[model samples]
Target: MRKPVLTIFYQFNPWSTTIGGIQTLINIFIKYAPPEFAVRLVGTANDKTQPILKWQSAEFAGKEISFLPLFSLKNDNVRSLIPTTVKYTAALLGQCFESDFMHFHRLEPTLAALNWQGEKTLFIHNDIHTQMQTVRDKKAILWRRFPAAYFAVESLLVPQFSQILSCNTDAVKHYKERYKSVSDRVAYIKNSYDNELFYPLNQEEKEVEKRELAQKLGLPDDTRFVLFAGRLHPQKDPTLLVRAIAALNDPCVHLLIAGDGELAAQVRTEIDTSGLTGRVTMLGAVPIAQLAQLHRICNVFVLSSAYEGLPLVVLEALASGTPVVTTECGETPKLLTSNSGIVCRQRTSECIADALRKVLQHPEDYPIESCVETAQPYAARTVVRDIYSEMLNRWEQRVTFAVKV
Candidate 1:
């Protein structure tokens, strides 16, 4: 029997843009797709010049990588929203006319997927419902909260999906409470990272790499680097690290931030205005290669996000045998067991600063071996394979029952 082809609908392709965690998640699967199945990815074209209906393909890890890019559009405006979404989904449905399963990545794609036919499964990456709700409740800028109105509408149809893979406990809890009728369908599925690139380096290897990284960034040998690599938006609260570091007043401790978002300028201003000038280096939106090295070379990996579905950066940091200080977002608190890391009681900068100081003061308490071991189960290959098997089993069983009828 031929393997079932899984069609995935995602907004961003790793090849097309600088979006990190989601892009990294897709790239890991692309690199390690199982031979038991063929994969198809449909996404919007990042390059405006690329005409619609264009596609590219290659054989990766003994599996076919079929990617089709539809025309991208602005979802902020009300008038063009529905029409553009129709065009996007129509284009997607045109390519994958038949499939065993259809995977929806984000909320926007899920809206479009309502028109596409298949055994649909939702892979929740972020708490879109709450994220959107925050925008709505806070009365954020019109452009920012425009999609909340759409999600609020399409959410009425969420019960149609038979399966939902929640990447964190919070997401699972959210689904259970939000969709009471379909609560039983939601299952926890931990997000994964590329272990091959993010694993811990031995002391000798780390020292060598650290020196090289230091020289590349023109930092002193004695500097203790703290890393935060995520969107500089309000949700991520990148300046929390700046404020924390500023309060610590540890001259030996430096912060390297690598991301860009709505509050990018504010992140810079916070570091500058707080006199964290020489201690902070904001390298807006770094490539994945350098980011992996940053994980291994840095002293601590911290995520100050107010809320996250499952921040892949936390896993990457753990995999690199680097201690972390993060908010109680997603599965972060559960993952920071023992002394492997510190979990902030709250999202306040003071909480982050206190946690940072403790982690730095007693760095020896966090064992490198345990940190790496904690991330072993979440390797991209294993997690992807597990999700693939579960989906295929359900699909194959569904097909068998249909044939019997």
Candidate 2:
């Protein structure tokens, strides 16, 4: 039998300068796609003047990854906003017409692009309802200025996909409840870590990286660090992480934030107002290779996100044998069992501070090995296989339904 041809439509591909959850997903997907699966990536071309469609093959763990580019022309203003949805939607519709199956990552465009006639799956990584609510409450510039046409499109097509896979169970349940027609289509596929790239460093390497990072970030030799490595967005709740560290009142406890976003100015204001000039360091954007080193040097990984589907960084941090202190976002309890790490109440500076304190006060007592093992099941191969198996089932169902029709 001929293997199915799968084309992935993601607006935000991994080639972007800074890393985020979407980038991590693509990296893992490339690593895990089998030889029999003729996988092709269809993303908005990164550079202008590039061909609308381009293809290439690269070896990942000795398996070849066939990549294709689908360019979407955009006005910078509209592109930064949501009309890019229209762009990607058209691009995906074209691909769906061409490929045997189409898999998508982002929610907005995916919702708009899903076709019931095609073998389609939407990969959701966060609660869009919650994210939309936050944006409405904040009246963010992006929300206020963008076209409302996309929202209308999302309302109609979000439930039409052949399958909907959220990164965590909470998101899956929420989407299922909200869209009963597609309840059976909604499922959970947890995020995975790249064990090969993110792992505990040996003593010599750890010592050298720690010393170098300290020197580069202007930290003292004795300073123990708690690191946050994602976009500095309002939803990511970086200010809360800063407030937590300030509440600690521990001069030796340094907070390292390693990403940039629209909320950069707000985070800078908070850092200045809190008088955490030297204590809180913002390494605007670091390369992926350097980020792994930063994870190794840090004693604890921290997140205070208002919401998450399932953060890949948490798993990455754990695989690196770094203890964690995370807000009670999606699947926080699932990630933090009895002996893993501290999970705090949501959006509270005091609660975050308390959790950080517990990890900092007695770091040796926390089972770092258990934290590492907890992430073993969600390794890249396991996650990709889960996605592949689910796609196969969905494809077969599509065929059966078509035969009946």
Candidate 3:
């Protein structure tokens, strides 16, 4: 019998600026999909005008890979709102016409599965329900109608899928509790890092890149830089990080904000007003190639996210032999148990400041090499195999049940 063809749909490309935890999960799916399964990765280009297709026949340690891009029809930040609806609508209609099974990676594609009329697997990365609720609760959405609209749209779509693959244990538990279905329909699979691209930097390479990075960012060789990778959005809470750094009152403790987002202006304003301009360096967006150097140069990495489903930057930082100081959200505490890093009790500026200070003071005690070793199990290859084995076992059980029937 022929192997099953799995169609994996994502809202954005893996290389895009918005790439983070969700993107990492998609990359792992591409890396770890079983060889017996022919995988088709579907995503939209940041723009809304063209379709893209990237094919790879070679396996990542015996797992096959392929990519398909369905660009949005409009060129706007609301690409997911418009292009995703159109592209995924077409994708679903096409899939239904041909009759195929699909596994979608985010909320937008969950809508597509409603019309797919096939076995649908929903991969919930960042919960749209939570996001919409957050904006509404904080009154950040401004227009009361939009939050209601998003909530209604989400309510109309998310529950229609056949199965849901949650990114972390907390998410799985939340879904099961919310939906009142604790069965295999909602399963927890923690994300993994791309060890091929993100790993421990050697001493020589680290020294060279650290000096070069300091030079490029206009930092003194003695400056102690803490890194904040990922988006500069309200959710990421870079402003909170700035407040935390300011509260620390340590002149030597500098912060480097990597990546860009909608709240860039606000973050800059916070840094300026707080008089942390000299202490905080905004590197904007650093290339993936230079990320290791950035991680190496920093004394520690920090993630001040309001929420997360296992932030991939944390894993990347750990893999790069850098201890982390992150907010205690999602799976952070699980990873921090071994003293690889410190998990703040809350996302408050005071808590974050205390955590940062504690880590900075005992940098030597927080073994970077130990952090790297701790993160190895979550490497892309290893996680991929775990996922494949999970899916394969489930499939085998279904086959056995069918045979008995």
Candidate 4:
């Protein structure tokens, strides 16, 4: 029996970077992809200095996977657009023909390979229509101004894909409604977390780890750490978290931000303006191990994002037995329970403040066991296994139909 080659494509390198949830999810998919299939990862190099088209092999989770790095411009300015698109499209057309199936993580890459005649799948990480409307940054808003153009492209491209996967159920509904022609192909697949690395720690163990971490980070032993671990982008609304913390007005509550992005300076300014300098610590892009430890030690995890698909950070926090206080975005409201965390009624800082205060004030209400239990179904092994099985079944059906024709 010959194994089908599944070429997974994304804009950024997953093995070398911790950029976002998409990269994390792709790694999990590759790790748990069934043995009956051969998987190849195709992505752009993060380093601008790296040459365009190159092939390499990387060992991940004890398995050797083929990698193809394509060239991408540093910025998406007018000057770079033509060359970037031409190079990307040419590279995909030249390299992707041999694969049995193509899996794309972003719209741009899928569009570049629009001519690919083989089976194709597109994974929608966010509600594209909502993100275009909600993004507040000047540069992002400028690009999103031409929403009609994007809609036209999506209409032409989406139905051509054999399958459409969205982590958010709301996003799945949106896609089905918008692309009624391919409604049957649209499906909801939940994002997963590494359960092995992010499980509950006992009270005594948590206390010991907290003490060590506080000592290392120069915080008081009794400080209640509220963690926000995502890119400091307009969509994430990181400054909103700062304002919420300041509004809480609790001197004992401290914030530890574990990621950085374009809005880092703006978030810092917000912290300074709100007089939260001493109370907030910017840990700036900690590794996954450190992130899990932070989740276990932190009293609560917070996300004040304007929008999301199904945030992996929230799931990771729950797996680490940490309660969450997040705004109502993506599938969060459905994923959360009363015992797991609080979902803010509004996106306002005051609403987030009140939610945070409640969770911080009554820690006993959200037990470690309850939080961990809430995240059990999203364990990487279970979710990825099911996803691969589904992919294989779809491929089998396509083959049978082709043979009949």
Task: Indicate the worst ten consecutive residues by lDDT in candidate 4.
Answer: 75-84
- Tens-place lDDT digits, model 2, residues 339-359: 668888656888888888888
Cα lDDT tens digits, model 1, 34-80, are 67777887766656665556667745345577877676643211223
Clashing pairs in 1: none
Best by TM-score: 4
- Per-candidate TM-score against the hidden true structure: 0.87, 0.84, 0.81, 0.91
What ranking emerges by lDDT with the best candidate at the front? 4, 1, 2, 3
Candidate 4 accuracy as TM-score: 0.91
RMSD versus native structure for model 2:
4.0
Better of 2 and 3 by lDDT: 2
lDDT of 3 by residue, 111-227 (tens): 545655656777766544454555412532332337766556656776676778776677787777766643557887667887877777665666676667667767776667789
Off by over 4 Å in 1: 48-50, 59-63, 72-98, 128-154
lDDT of each: 0.74, 0.73, 0.69, 0.81
- 334: Cα error in model 1, Å: 1.9
The candidate with the higher TM-score, 3 or 4, is 4
lDDT of 4: 0.81
- For model 4, residues 181-293, the per-residue Cα lDDT tens digits are 89999999888998778898998898888888778878788888899998777778888999999999999899999887778898999999999999999987677778888
Between candidates 2 and 4, the one scoring higher on lDDT is 4
